[model samples]
Target chain A: MANIAHTVHVGLGDRAYDILIGDRLLDDAGALLAERFPGRRYGIITDDNVAKAQLPRLLASLDAAGLQHSEIVLPAGESTKSWDLLGQAVEGILAARLERGDLIIALGGGVIGDLAGFASAIARRGMGFVQMPTSLLAQVDSSVGGKTGINSPHGKNLIGAFHQPKLVLADLSTLDTLSPRQFASGYAEVVKYGLIDDEAFFFWLEENQAEIFAGGPARGEAIARCCAHKARVVLEDETELGVRALLNLGHTFGHALEKDTGYSDRLLHGEGVAVGMVLAHGFSARQGLAPSQDTGRIVAHLKKAGLPTTLAEVPGTLGSTEALMAAIAQDKKVSRGALTFILTRGIGRAFIEKNVDPKAVSSFLDDMRG
Target chain B: MANIAHTVHVGLGDRAYDILIGDRLLDDAGALLAERFPGRRYGIITDDNVAKAQLPRLLASLDAAGLQHSEIVLPAGESTKSWDLLGQAVEGILAARLERGDLIIALGGGVIGDLAGFASAIARRGMGFVQMPTSLLAQVDSSVGGKTGINSPHGKNLIGAFHQPKLVLADLSTLDTLSPRQFASGYAEVVKYGLIDDEAFFFWLEENQAEIFAGGPARGEAIARCCAHKARVVLEDETELGVRALLNLGHTFGHALEKDTGYSDRLLHGEGVAVGMVLAHGFSARQGLAPSQDTGRIVAHLKKAGLPTTLAEVPGTLGSTEALMAAIAQDKKVSRGALTFILTRGIGRAFIEKNVDPKAVSSFLDDMRG
Candidate 1:
């Protein structure tokens, strides 16, 4: 009924899917779901945190569409993204007697989406999953990629399969429930779009920093735009074989920061990502590829949006570039000996570069202390 | 270079792969691997049992191909197909710095193939995997299908993904190490081809049982023929959408029997299937679909091959039809409200029937006690 029409294409041959974004999109869920999951049964996977807030609306929409559904709630956060939790969730789905054609609706943030997606990938030797993202971070990044997996004791997402979601539904209306800090944390990924590609969008965010930080329908639109950009890159390279690594622009550094805190609640993903992006830009400037003014502007924009923009600002964060390099090597983005670094020549344009010298990165780390 | 040129076709559109059968196929491992792997740093996964007996030849072949490889030897057995073992294997692969385009080689019997294939499927969001099946069961079944997974405390293959191998090498030479019992166990599946389809093959086995049971070059040819037949069926319908379910001729009963015995080595998979085939045929006869003589003849063949063909012979087996039915419901093969029963009109014409009355199945179970 609303003037809603937006799509994010994930490139994975026939396995590729679309992420549909717009206002009141949840209301139109039935038609879109019927197009993919024409089965009688639909299984919804959410977290306790999300089910309390958004389950009612999703159910009402599906009910209106005459879809029979069951729900399973998981614990919230990265802690629940374990193999044990994944197995438990799968057992719950199995209990519901979900057939091969049944849909696994991942209704929550990234953690819920990742776990549910991974579960569906293995359940019945691969089934269909739909991503219903409720957080800014999930809406922009995770909900689109087919990279599904759970964490192992050795590392995060160490155990998982490549399961693509049949569709992704990002209700702009869902972003209404957010603390200012959480909202800003998601904006970090929004800024990533510019640092990786699309300098124009980065410039647009630069101009609308105040309005974007205000958190409303406008901010939600901005988030959707960023997700659309991500979906395009993913569709081009579903497995991160080539250009998809660019999407991890700030993730290599971000993961290390998250790991340093043992992936605790001290720093949310986007907060770490914000800091990592600034540092990446700073490193680019040190390499004489990016202007210092551009790096300062990027840092200022993130700071103004209430996001952290420096390693110094992150307390209890590890400082060794060697440690960071080691972490980077462990990152999913590394291909052979070459590391795919998404860097900026300026705010409006991002490029993926390989064989980035770790010594130069170390030099950048040396300058950070001074 | 030996004449190794047989291929099994798993039908999944573009995701389909081939299983090649012959001798010294490992010599062309490079050319085959280059088509799929095409990169440096491959992960060679085998078990302690396989490593001691066969890993050298595989490594030597890789060396001849000028391929750089690393090896991870897991402890052998069904017990090792746990999350703890998978975690250790993934960590070992990561420690070796294996990347996205790099490959993982599953070299051993069914246990090693399933575990390693599953590991490759999840590691870094799915990498290339080569199936160098060293056991008869692995060659004809597990190696051809993309059904990669690990066993859980709850059930076998409760946790897994559909990650197909890039290429499969089912060298007949590997069968030389099988003990007579092991060789007989594999023969059970070989007999399955006749019970499910191809009456000619069943009659052929009837005439050639002595020669084939000798586990010589002729046995390899027979095994290859069976794999080729299965490959065509798999290629036509990779997901078991319809006709594929017929392949599970005795698996429903066999899997439950295995579960009853705690999936221990006491009852080899092939032996369990042998008894299961007899039970399934007996049930079919009770349903008036086939004559009792069919069941008698099938059971006689299994007994002649030294395979278990009766419930009383099952080691530590217990419980009622209801318990076996419950386990059947938990099977990845079950869909809707009924078990997918693979029953024959007679020898060599199996079909999958849905919604068969459970009470009839219960009565058939009661008859098995006699």
Candidate 2:
């Protein structure tokens, strides 16, 4: 009866869905899915890591309920988001003979969710999917926005679709399996919600930080709050056409840093974001757009959480300013050859700047290099 | 100006767009596009064949209007709708640095339209695109529906997205270059609109078939009529949850035969569809669901248009009933493992028939082989 802990609904008209967060939700997944999506066969798309740790629980649940399903396990890594793996995932879905009416269950973190969700988007000309995010970064960010895609050689997430999921199940207990670094990396995104436009939430997180990290009751509340904030922004601009760009507060810079590292362990996605968030704040202060103290406070907060707060902290030798600038120009946010970025006025007061100057960006990166 | 002929509006709320059918449209593409989508850069995706025949006209038009654009040309044929080509197209667009503010011009027949349109749908997580269909098959059928996709080894159009274009320009003069066989092959889809729900249009085609074939005034009228009919269906069921299934009246049977033929010249798509349409009627008649003579009438019309209306007329070996059944089961139209098909009661009276018996379909194919 207590399988559920908290729930957030994403109201996108007919495309709207619910997000459930709990400790033992995976144990009751069979009943949960059966009650929500009746008569639909499931195609569970997961990564190798999640398959060993999490797939069996979901499979056991479905089997116990006598619900029909198939599984597609791919290599687990940022590199898995490619045209080759995308084709394999889709071909597997087709080989399983899952109809458009059947549902695709994306059962992993951002990489698997983005790949599987994009596969579902194009398979049979778009199928419904549900996200079962096992990582904190995914549960708070990628899984909610319906922004599903794979990375191109040109850049990360340069090819994809805005395909929303029918539901999202975030099992709180699964967080136990993540390495300490992975957990901290995902926490960077949780911090992003507060930095985007919620000063009050940022203050609240500072207070509840230790408990959330310790797996206290505050952990569930923190995730729910992040989801609710994201749900509000997504509801306002589902397509990233306007207000939704706010969600990319640190992503534009984060992506360039990721590409600089060849998207490797030298910097995890969230680690890149932790540094990028600091850079974003520092750049805003340099532009006289915000108080310098706010940027300093953010650096301290992220540093205390065991997250990298500067480019110098990235293990590998950093790429040149020119190379990083080239990556930024190639990012999907460019408009009419002008750089578009999420620049902030202060903590929780981010805004979309469409006419960003590339020279300014290069200069900022140059100064940050020291 | 005599540059334009007819325009059909597909109203899907904010996603609505116009389908323009006319003579000299390709020559006028630059001006037309400049007027409709100002400030957006363009990426023209076409086939090598179309690049030779019609690409110059479009480029000259854009040049005259002072528009910026890039090109990506692939080999011509159904095989170009593979994952490899799709990757090439998306990479080309990204390499061209076409941002979300830009637009992709799908400038060729169904193969290019489906491939490029799909690329645009996924590139940068959904950019704008315009369809400039040259071949009759694309102009009359594929261009208007927003059902863009590529084929899988398993089946035709098994991978794709329902991404609507900003606008669709079916250049009538381009059809003049089509081989007579190719032209007739496209006429099958024109006849399909009439058969789907418009008995009067079917009769009209029967009466004016000669003039339409001769490229008379009736040709433009026929194409416009088909576009209008498709527009209505798409507006009502953009994602095809219900009535949209009617559009697949002959697709189930057609797809199996196409797969059997390796999607080659052994049986062009329209030829397979012609035979499929006849089989649908014949099967309906055998089941006491339709008038037997209607099947005969359809065969006569299709034959006169130089389309194959029987399996024996196909250029290569016909697979056994079991093989064809296997392909049919693998098609995207199957529902809950039951044979779901567009089975009609009579002409212009198609209905979605779920729970269709696969054994009956197998035996029916056995009878049709004779």
Best by lDDT: 2
What class would a CAPRI assessor give candidate 2's docking? Answer: high
Q: In candidate 2, what are the lDDT values of residues B1-370, reduced to their tens digit?
A: 5367888998888999999888989888889889988988999999999999999999999999999999999999999999999999999999998888899999999999999989989999998899999989999998877888999998899999988999999888999999988898899898888888999999999999999999998999999999999889988888888898888878899989999999887788888888888888888888899998888888898989999888888887888999999998998888778888888788888788988889999999998798
Return the TM-score for each candidate structure: 0.92, 0.99
* Candidate 2 lDDT, A1-370, residue by residue in tens: 5367899999999898999999968878888889889998999999999999999999999998779999999999999999999999999999998888899999999999999999999999999999999998998888997999999889999999999999999999888899989999999999998999899999988998999899999998999999999999989999888998888888888999999899888889999899988988898899999899999999988988899998899887888999899998999887778888889999999889899888988999998889
lDDT of 1 by residue, B41-126 (tens): 67999999889878888888788778899999999887888877877777788788787778889999888888899889888777
| lDDT at A297, model 1 | 84
| Position B93, candidate 1: lDDT | 81
Candidate 2 residue-wise lDDT at A344: 91
Q: Which window of ten consecutive residues has the lowest lDDT sum in model 1 chain A?
A: A1-10
Scored on chain A only, each candidate's TM-score is 0.91, 0.99
Give interface RMSD, per candidate. Answer: 2.3, 0.7
Looking at model 1, the pairs that clash are: A10-A235, A11-A235, A149-A160, A199-A348, B10-B235, B11-B234, B11-B235
